[model samples]
Target: MKLVWTQIKNFRSIKDSGKIYFNPNLTILAGKNESGKSNILKALECFSLDKFNKDTDFPIDYIEEEYPEVIVHYQLEEDIVIDLCDTLKINKENAHKISGVTVTRTSEFLESIEVDIFKDTLEYVIDAVGEAIKVINRELKRTFKLDINSKSSYLLSDLIEKIDSYLLTIKEFFNEEQSNKLNSIIEEVVSHLEMLNGFSDYISDKKFKATIPNFIYFSSFEDIIPDSISSNEEITPIVNRFFKVVNQNPKLLFDESNPQRRRLLSDKISAGISGDFMDYYSQDSVSLKINLDGDDLNFFVYGTDTQKPFQPRQRSQGLQWFLSFYLTLQAEMKTGSVLLIDEPGLYLHASAQEDLLGMLNNLSDKSPIVISTHSHWLMDPNRLERIRLVLKVNDQTQVENKIHKGADAYTMKPIFSAIGLGLNNDISTFGERLILVEGYSDYYYLEAMRYYFQEILGIKIKKFKIYPCLGSAQIINVLTLLVDSETEYFILLDNDKAGRQTEKKLKAECGIDENKILFTPVKSKNTSVIEDMFSQKDFSEIILDSLDTNKFDKVLVSKKFNERMHNNEITILSDETVSNFKEILDVVATPKFSHREN
Candidate 1:
């Protein structure tokens, strides 16, 4: 199941958050220091599989008077729904009626949080038992002028007792075969009664909890791994995670008397952590060593160049936080978990913080990540559509629907990828990996489409460094600067008159490979330009006239289109429009077509 949206009311600082939509992969809650960004994330966390405290969770003013509620909606994936139906014995045909579900975890029911599932898949099984009861009652009335009223007799045992006594009175009215047939009908009804009670017990125990993905919250990494822990000492959460990652019995490793046995376990643990931890921490080629000499298991890190082991605390604070966070994520998470990460990359420097964002993107591919951060370095300007600006109005939390500022982190450095020299670039170097669009308007459309590919569609795509060359003739001008670049090039243009004329010039002037050109496809295959790649109705409304092309307004249409794309208003687009962009991206992603060296 995919988490779609959430609404919180009277939770801490938030009085009401009006249906905040979540991106399929990632959603960032961004704001200033005390603007309640973390509080908003905490409200999401209170969709508790555990208990919720009213005093701590409810708003300060409305603590005793009001109850807080956090309601989340999920889109049921077909495969997951099928698996659930198989487990619970629900009809697959009836399951089709429910494609989405709303779950409300609220304090309204009691002091503790209560979970209510709307239009659950188990409804099919529940309703089947109800229909069976009505059918049996109808047959009884037709044959014996009797009706089984469950409301009058609440217990299944009571109903069974009443039927048993009544059957004795009617036994003389029928022959042996007729009496057996009557008993058989009642027996089938009894089976249904048992099944209904069993289902009720299943619901009371919250057995359907497997179908709903639980949120795993990690607030921060305040402590690093301990230098030494005793063999019999109570294991803290951090130490517990460390042993789990290594798949080692910490007590056995510490208590071993044989030096050789201790060395074997220690070496295996050191090598395992070094391989996994090196993937995220890039500052140094550091290796972890676990010492099992005495009752205490000690930890240390040493650079590969210099084998002198140093305590974990001796390393940079940022590296320590990175390892702590990574281990917690690996230990606490399961296959279908949703992550709630708060203010990651707080201690890291600028360059390392950027790398942390890349790691988060990789994690988002597997599970839905709702991360909160005020830091700009963690922001991706192309993914501006994913940002929900969190702030406080009249002492209550208010999350803005639109991103007006767009990557509030770039205020100091004046560095945002969307400023035209996109992705990672300065003024002089316009990034090595190039994707040249036709004009500024084409650039905006492609950038918005990249977010859709990554977050909504879950497509693995290159972090494209798109730069518009203004026109087809200007493609070579951008190519000249990236003559000896490392990555692939993508030249996007319309399938029209000027585009055909300019294609030949690209090969002659830039010495570009024919395979590098990724043309935007149009469905109609008429005299179509890049704009015609969209729906015919949308194109006529947003760009050209409904019938006549003479009333075209490029500047006005481009401005309106850009605004709508940022606000995520243009998402109700035709599948053909999305397919056109996907085809172009498919070519761009293909690395088998090698780049020509200048």
Candidate 2:
């Protein structure tokens, strides 16, 4: 069983976060501080078995008589479904039609993980009863046929009762062998109905809970442990994580009397941790050491400067952060549980953050991570699908994953950072096929369009990269780089006066080929700009979200449209929109190889 989707409602900072689809590996929640990024992690933690704190969780803004709920959907594998059916003794007919399992955890003083596996059972039972009735009618044409095609109850008990009544009149006609067959089928169906009569308490709540994943939330920054702590002090989660490493065996870890035994146990754990740390951290000279005293547990970092070790504080914060982050997760993480980390990239430089990212990728296979961060170094420039933009709009937390050309400051800066615009060297580094759009807005729309064609339309578009330039005037400046690199490229521009002027300049003055210059809405009438391709209603609505009183600043509209697409709230429903995008897609999808490098 794997957690596939989730939504949190009536929770802190979020009236409703909408449905957030996981990336199958990890979900990166990116935004600036106080954007309610951490609140997302907290809300998900509520999914942990029988856990809730009303006083702390209930938001002051929400006064409605409703439970703060977290609805989780899990995809149960065929093997898991088969096991569940066998354990629950469900009818084979019902079990065969199994679908995803949904678990809704709600807090209204009494908290519970309410599992809904009944959909599969109900769906199958209805159709199975209908089909069985047809068989019964065909089996016995002499007696009154069961006209139960319109039967709504679909209950196996109801079907058994009707079958028994029909059998009473037909048993005299059946031989002993035929009578036994009918009797056996009726007896089996009747037993299954009674077994599941009262929602299958016999299935066991524990058994159901077993399939629902338990969420384990860990924050490296918040839970970073002190260097030394008394044995009597309350065990912080970090310390508990340490205890977990030794399998909670405190004897050897705190045995001050036998120095050799304590040092021996500490060395073994330290060596294991240091080995794994080196795998990601790449600091060969550094080593990890632990000191077990009867009064306190001490952590030390060994460096080449001296044989004697120094405290973790003496090392860089990045090193300390990684140590705590690594130990805690390695000890606590279990197979099937999702890991929630808040700003795992904190205190790390670019290289170290990337090292942490590699560690996270490995851990993702074991326990998928949902990380909240404002850092760009930790982000993968390639997988924009992993990012969920957490923003506070009207003070309510909103999570989004898509954007369009009309998006303003609300999307531009973060997306640029998420895509590593600053971190990346240049567009020239990309592969052969490149599309140079006039500006940021053009780039956004084309990217969104490319995604629509590939994902929704199931059309395998070209592996092309879209780069933006400073409008028609800067086309030569960008084209110069493409020519020098010998990268095949095309100029995508508007059908306006300025674009037409630039197109002539490129062909006549720069010796550029006409075929290499593609125009948006190229085939559409009365469409000058790429924005003109979309229906007026869609273009205006997307621009409206920019919250810009001035026309140019309304960037929110495009972002909203992209978000809706990512959220699956909307798609290319408009015939005009599809026609307009398809017009552009037809050009971009095709290879334009004939380019005069000048």
Candidate 3:
């Protein structure tokens, strides 16, 4: 069975809501913080619950004293319906039955009776008499056998004929509409009750809790393991034991921790898994164990031999955050639960962050994963239908609100732009390819070049988008975005001192693979730049060659001067600002072609 729709009223930030359809396989709730995304999730959790804990406030009130209610609707398999019916004690005669046959037959009988009755007002009176005769006929049929000379039957038949004659005469006096109305009333009174056995069985069946399966969530940051174990042991036992509890029995997750019992284990377990995994511990391949002399716990991290435990708060904020979520994933797997992770990419190295995203994608096939993050590195546009945007509208606004599925990167670009989120664009639109330019000159230059290329080559290129740093000083920011996106970048910068410094900064700060960057050679001899200026120079010569000699002579101050000297701004050339060379001026004049390209 899958939850098809859910509605909430006066619940926290949600003043009112309508049906929210969910994909059974995966449903994601995403939005900037405080958009009521969490509230919707909470409502789902609340609707399916048997009881609310002390942490929860019941009957959430948003309008003065109005109580809020949440309703959840689900679609179940036929077998699940049967199980429900068996559990709810719904019988064949109960209203919970879903079949339509019995109800339809009863309706048809009533409709037929109404159609056949009194033809007019006069007929209505006659119909009453006809009804009396029918009743007498029924009595006769029940009380005695029909015989040639049964005096009692004959008397009843004579009375019925007399009534029928009066009813026919009266029918001729009344309008047809009035007669039909009267007939309908009579038919309704005579209709039998409908039997709803199927519905009863289905509705009365036992309710089963929806258990969403779980997946892993890796954090983005990486940290160095301390050289010496601080009185620590391996985390193998703790990891294995936690998974055992989750897979074996998830209910224990809800149980309050027994401080005394846990303390005894803590001396040997140090930071053993918490939350919902303690109850299902079964000896598995994963070995979770205590470390830091029972003060910490560690778990296996791929591509490494020794287990790493949680770090001290002062060590690294990102690592500390990551460890918490990593542990949560391990715990979730054991309980067959869904994972709800918020921002798993905090404080991690770029490489580590990419690795984390890869890990999560792999785990999603096994279980549903719901992550609320601002990082674009984790998004895969082709697989974006699972994404949902939670929009929070002002209560004062008299407008309808809804949740929308994110279709692709292009679809979400405007939304990301509104929130100042460059990450989403980098992931969905640019992917792993980047073009880093020094400033707006490069930005506009690249754009212009692209247009020219498309027209010249007749082949469109849109693999990578150019990112213009405000200046050479912002190269580090550009590099970080590129690295986080896990793509190589081509840094096109001016060959000036500032540009060289920019390159050095990226090299020292970023230390990414050499293949990731495509830089210029430092020496003047290596100035074989693949630039638009050189191309423009060739194009300029072609245009000068094609122009009328007389037109050029009129524009040039001295025909004997070299073509280069006339083109240079320093030399005296023409009185008019416009040039005889149309190609260059035409390109510059056209708004579409004038923009710069990196």
Candidate 4:
């Protein structure tokens, strides 16, 4: 089962969050600080919690003293519904009506079925007996001067006996064919009545609970306590729970009698933590050890650089937080669980945050993760479909699942910061007129070309800020932010299918003017990328400098350029690469800005 939507009322800052929809794999709740992003995660956490606190959780604006109700709606998968039916003893026919099925008394079962087939059969039998009694009464009154009253006790008993005998010999009352038809009708009616009764009984007797998805909520990294400190505190329960999950026996942590079990558990945990540490640091010789100091668990890491072992607290805060979070998830989380992480990359550096992002993405394959984040490195630009904008409106929290094309500057600030921070370079504050490119290499090449054109052609062009959009797909997100900033911008996309599609989408969906969009000029008929703007010889030389000369090929230069650019190395544009670059600048610099005095 998956949580398709959520609505919170009278919960903290959110009065009524309307209906916040979710993506199956990953849902990112993004907003400014104090926009109640964490509150939304907490509301979801309520589903898994055993008790609720009205005083702390309820909205203060509520005038009446009433308990707060947090209602969450879930969608059950077909397999889950089938399993539920089997568990509840609900037959296949009745299972179809599970969503609408209600308890009804045995006396009220007849009213529950609209098609009264059982009632009709009883009526048919009663009429047949009445007719036979009428004939008997007429014959008795004429021959013996005796009229039989249908309501008289003796007459009723005699008539019931005759009806019973007639029903027993029902086959004799009709031909073989008629008997078969009659029996079939009676059997069908009987089966329908039995099914109705059984369904009613099942509904009345069985208490079926909704299959609530398991929710695991993680807030700030500060809440994560190191395994070294052994105390009966808030984190002790989580540690105990994690140990039980990892070893299936919490006693192994303290049971001195079972040294073998203790050793085995320690080795397993040590190997698991060491493996994660190696993957994280990309070092083969890194070793991790888990030791029990009295009742407390301690972690010690040994790196290839240092012979001495150091505790986790001795490491950076970011590494400590990440290790704790990762280990906790590994030990505590089960398959099909829903993870709610609040500001996951809060402590990590931008690069480490990226690694955390990748880990979260991989973890999402096993369980759906809904993360509330202000970090751009955490948000996947390619998966904008999973983003939800949490905003404060009229003092109530509102979550918008749809990404607005015309999002204002304030709303787009976090995204802009995220993108800019991830690039590790601030967008040039040269001029309001922005020149957007597909990638970093494009920005570097264009800037070099602009200078070359100014020097060679003696035409001083308007200096526009060269902004790299990271990818063609991310252009719209940047544009949305730029438009809000009232920044006049022009796009230079690669002459490829993806670039063309992005250009078309920018024009149609984002309402970008067609004249503002430009494609790289290429001599060949093949689809042109940013690398095409430069001479093949110049680009190949740059590639050779970065990669092995033996690996250099005309066909592989473009791919190599991208690889080099990702490593923050851009090949400077030469004089020979000026024509295509000059052409693009000439068009963009036309009547757009005040001309520079020659």
Candidate 5:
């Protein structure tokens, strides 16, 4: 089963009832900060726990303290259809029984003699023929007057009038011997006319019907722990209660009457939870070693370390989160569960983040996963369909979220293709390969170089798209996602320390071949697009080396731009030349007067 959709009513920043859809594979929630982005997940967690209230951390009121309710709608896959149907009160074959019947009876006299009074008389025939001929002849004349010219048309029209005028008289000419045959012909013609009168009613009745989804809930605790600890033996009952509700176990986890079942659990604990590199070790020290002998149940973690029993409370915050997520996933796999994880990348390393994402993706193959995060490192470009941007519009009360799924990524600044000649989307739409770049200058210079190569060398270099991110910090994540989906991405970052480090990280993380990436040569340390231009005086000479940058910088930093920047007309880097000049001054001067504090 999978969570198909969710509805929220007056929940925290959410003012009215609204629905958000979920894909079976992944559902990503994105927002700048506290736009109540995490509220929906928190609500689902609350519902899972079957404990929701105003005082809860999952705030259900933005303007005032209002209790809001959330409903999660779900559907089961084919294998679990029967179980789901039972849960939703659906019986596919048990439709409302239609047993009552409408009565309609007739005697032979009423059926035959009464209706026979209005026989196929000449008058009746004349009236029906007159109406039919008028319609057919009028249409014929309007449609094909040229084909049925004067003389030939006269015969057709005269015949029609004759048949209409003598219809009653002609009917009287027939005896009882031929009456039945004529009656049959008349009935057939009437039936044909009835059919032609209007369209079949089926068109209006044939339509698709929608099925309302089943409702379910998922709950979690900000701080989940036992309320009382009377004895070491009591720990089992509390743990059992929590696990029973959590896993939705058919039999109670704490059913002491079933010793055989308890033995199975004990056996499982003895065998241990072992993986490729680790094994679980547990000890009931408080029960077996201390006064309350047969009471305590102690759990421990064992991996790349010595043997020692540890309580769940003593584990690191990160470890607790991991184990909780792991157990939750396992339970969900058994019950066809949907998972909602908020800021899952918290305390996770870059490698671990990728592994966790993969694990989630794998589990999602069975159910659905909805994640909310602020980390760009968690974004998978190939899984762009799962990303959603949450925004608060007009006021602080309502949240507006937009889901992007197409092949394009939006940026305020202009982006160029790999060759720096064409626009970003144009290349992505047309090119077969891509070279991801860093910023605007690299994009502009590449476009100009592509033009030179095409014009002077007659080389076809427009077959590539160049994507310019502000930095290569997200390149590994982007490449990891795209490469797995069979998209070829080549990096062309600067040779600076940060850029080199980014390249190394990308290779280590994504296993991308070095040959595919086009790193700037080490010998050309001072040969960057920015540096190349700074070493020149006349714009004409500078244009010879990188014509695109020279033109863009000169035109972009003209008096018009200076006026706008000086008057505070444009805020973000109003003039490229001024920006570049600032960078140069920073590099040369001792204590540079930089606009950027960093």
Candidate 6:
């Protein structure tokens, strides 16, 4: 089953968060602090757990009047219907009727109803009535001139009326038994029709909480281990469950005669944790030691070089968090649990966060993971469909699946930062000059050249920031936000059709001076992009080093420039390319060039 969408209303800061759809594997709820991202996750938790306290969980603004409600819409896999049928004790006919359902929650009750329960029965009645009409038409061909040969030829309402009217007229011609059968058929059809029409009355919530999938919420790993060895009271529910799974009997740890059993159990659990840690951290031979001393469970880790084991708390926060999280999930999570993680990599470095992303992706194959995060590194830019932007509008929280084009710069700042442009007002003003590039590759190439020029020639260029616009079209949007009175802006566009159109819009539509729009110097070809500014030999060598030789193409070179730059292996540029770069820098750095039309 998949949580396809959710509708939140009057919940916390959210007055009405219009229906928000979710991605199948991963759904990222992204927003700034206090923008109600956590509130949305809590609402989902309440929906899954079916527990809502009016005084605590209810929206404070509306708590006096009435508690708010949460509605969750789900799309179940076909096989899950079989399980539902078995659990509900519904017969095959009714079981087939039990399609996907919607769950709604209020302070008083949690309700569930089948989305299309009456569809099959209604279809059956329609087909049966049409067949009867066909029989009547054939039998009374000369007597009546009704053209009800095919059900598809007429609407359901018109067909029903025609059949009813014809049946009444023919009642006198038939005997008592025949008249009764005809009446029963019409009555059955009408009854089914009534049931189909009265869908709202037929559905009600049941007490089958077992049918709802479990929601496991993990915010932190601090409580994964017990504080002392006195008792297991401080251990988290997930940890307790993990121990139960790892050890068939909890008392086995205290069995003095069965020391081998204790060692085997400890070794097994330790191996599992160690394997996962090694896989994610890419460390060589890290081992774990799980010791049950008295009523306490102690966790320790040993690196390859360490002679003694280190307590989990003594290690780095990221390592401890990752180990505890991975082990808990590996031991506790069942097949169909919906995992809700809030800020999963809060303490991890960028590289480890990336590893966490890979781990999350792997876990998603078993269960859907919905994570709330402010870290751009946590988001996969390649999967924009998995992102939902949360923003506060007029003091009401709104969750948007797609970022609105008209959203102001502040509203768009998170997404901009996720794509790697420092667009905050303070950072935007750090440089006296701004060089707008079409994409990240352009930014990287220019910055790399700027450094090269400074190093090779000792000519200190003016301090400028290269702002990548994501694309030529986005340039207009970025300009709308970043353009101010003090800053001098220059747009470097390719000499392609899109670049030309963008240039036209910048000048005519945006009132930007034509001189501010810079294009790649004309090479041999009329169509030249930023890549054409670099020498072919050096550019091809960089591409070859970054990607496979067979995949070396102009498109890939332009697209994967950021990845190549991050690799830090290709820093060489041809002398001609360096000269061309110097000339462009000289042109942009001129005092007269900075003062030309705002």
Per-residue lDDT of model 5, residues 1-598, tens digit only: 4354566655556654356656556777765567556776766665455455555543433334444555555542343334323433335352121111111111111101101111222234334544443443463452311122112212223433444343343346455664454565555445433322211121112220012221122232332232223332434333443343344331333343466655566444433333311221121111110011133333444334434544556655545445545555555555545667777757556555665666677776766677776654455433333555555554333322223111133211111121222333233332355667665345444434333334433433324555555467866644543543333556776767777787687778767777666544443364343334233342344333323553554322222222222223333322333344334222223243423322
Name the regions of candidate 2 deviating beyond 4 angstroms.
Answer: 88-99, 109-117, 120-199, 245-248, 255-257, 403-412, 420-598
* Tens digits of lDDT, candidate 3, 1-598: 3334455655566666665544343455555556666566655454434222323433233344444455544444455445544544434343223211100001011100000111122234334444533544463453322222212222223433444454454345446764564454444322210112222223233433232111233323333222223223453433433445435221232232665654465443332443222223221112233322233333322112334433344345544444444555555555555555555666766554555565566554455456655454455332233445566565310112122232234434433432223644344344445566665334443444443344432333444556655577876765655445655456665665676676677678778544444443333344423232333444344324445666553212111112222223222222221132222223222333232253
- TM per prediction: 0.63, 0.64, 0.39, 0.54, 0.40, 0.60
Q: Counting only residues 3 or more apart in sequence or on different chains, how many pairs clash (N, Cα, C under 3 Å) in candidate 2?
A: 7
Give the per-residue lDDT of model 4 (tens digit) for 504-559.
Answer: 89988998888899998868766987667778877667645655667554323433
Q: What TM-score would candidate 6 get against the native?
A: 0.60
Model 1 poorest ten-residue lDDT run = 110-119
- As a TM-score, model 5 comes out at 0.40
Candidate 3 stretches greater than 4 Å from native: 50-61, 82-288, 291-315, 333-336, 342-360, 395-598
Q: Lowest-scoring 10 consecutive residues by lDDT in candidate 3? A: 99-108
Please list all clashing residue pairs in model 1, or write none if there are none.
Answer: 376-409
Model 2, poorest ten-residue lDDT window? 148-157
State each model's CA lDDT, in order. Answer: 0.65, 0.67, 0.41, 0.61, 0.43, 0.65
CA lDDT, candidate 3, residue 510: 77
**What are the runs in model 5 whose C-alpha is more than 4 Å off?**
16-19, 45-267, 270-272, 276-293, 306-315, 394-598
Q: So what's the TM-score on candidate 4?
A: 0.54
Model 6, span 1-598: residue lDDT tens = 7676788877777788989876667778887777888888888888777787666677777755456678877765666666555544446576545665666776664354435454455466656566556656566674345454432334334444665665565555567775565776767766765554444333332333444545677776344553234344554565665565465455555453466766777778777666656776753356667776656667777888757888867777877777667765555345467777877878888778888888887777667788888777776543444678888788778987654333456656655664435465444332567778887557656766665555434466776766777799998987776556467778899889999999889988899988888888776898887777878887667645536767554433543453334324446668868766665677676642232232
Candidate 3 root-mean-square deviation in Å: 23.9
What is the lDDT for 58 in model 3?
36
Clashes of 3: 53
**Pairwise TM-score winner, candidates 1 and 2:** 2
After superposition, the stretches of candidate 1 with alpha carbons farther than 4 Å from their true spots are 63-65, 75-80, 83-90, 108-199, 205-207, 334-336, 404-445, 448-532, 535-598
Q: List clashing residue pairs in candidate 2.
A: 407-555, 408-555, 542-557, 545-556, 546-555, 546-556, 546-557
Residue 598 CA error for candidate 2 (Å)?
40
